[model samples]
Target: MKNKSIQIQEKHHKDLQKLSESLGQSYGKLVEKMILYFKRTGIDPDDLKNESPSHKIQQLDKRLVSFLKVQERDILKPLRQETYEYYQNYDKTLKDAKANINKNLGLLDNNSEIRANHILKELAKQRKALITLSEHLDPANKKGLKTVFQNIFKNAN
Candidate 1:
């Protein structure tokens, strides 16, 4: 391995030495590790001079929150409203259909009751006429068959 020297402030040199000893690494190894860290993270060393790490993290958190808010406003809020309106319209349509069906059923019930009553009256009249005809045709009747036939002919005239 070849050794190299670079000029730096005394304070920075002492700080680097203290950090190296605390980390249990040689001075050269510590510097190599620091270079590798910056390279892997793709961070500009000059950018760290203006802002602390905590400040950068806070900025990222704020950006993420704003992005979420925008998504909610642009996409989720409208979707939620549309879903609510669709359900409301569906509920109204269902209620209207149910009312129409109930009204039709009521009309059908009334019409059927009236028609059944009229049919029953017609059937009763027919039954009465059949009973009268059967009694006249009966052999046991005191009025003979000849008398019944003569009466039928007279009525026809």
Candidate 2:
């Protein structure tokens, strides 16, 4: 490839550098991507002749939104779905654990100490599993699940 250099104002250069870092791309790659985007959008470089800073920022924001939507569709949505399924499984496991503990409590008269120890052990295991699953969940789901587990533990005690 042929090398070319263009002089930009220091402020604009700094802004470009920041943009490159934010996008996790090298300066050259970022510029190439931007050029490709303009081409794909049928935007002529010359048409930006009188673009103000705010206008430029608005354009960048539009591109950012588009990028985020694509990311959500291509990546985040599937991951969230998987996480939701895992969360459901964990919730079912928690319910099963609670049911077993309750059944053991019902047999407390026959082997009270042994059954009590077993219930405590099962609760601890469930709590640990909940914590681990919560860590893997997205923020909103994590908060809800954590709250549920907290309530369950509080009630158990």
Best by TM-score: 1
Please give, for residues 56-155, the per-residue lDDT of candidate 2 as tens digits.
8999999999999999999999999999999999999999999999998787685778788999899799898886777578456645887777788789
Pairs that collide in candidate 2 are none
Tens-digit lDDT string for candidate 1 (1-157): 8998778899999999999989999988998999998898777888846576699999999999999999999999999999999999999999999999999888786779999999989966865675567576775766565456547656755
After superposition, candidate 1 runs with Cα above 4 Å error: 38-54, 110-157
TM-score of each: 0.58, 0.33
RMSD of candidate 2 to the truth, in angstroms, is: 25.1
Clash counts per candidate, in order, are 0, 0
Off by over 4 Å in 2: 1-57, 108-157
Evaluate residue 103 in candidate 1 and report its C-alpha lDDT on the 0 to 100 scale: 93
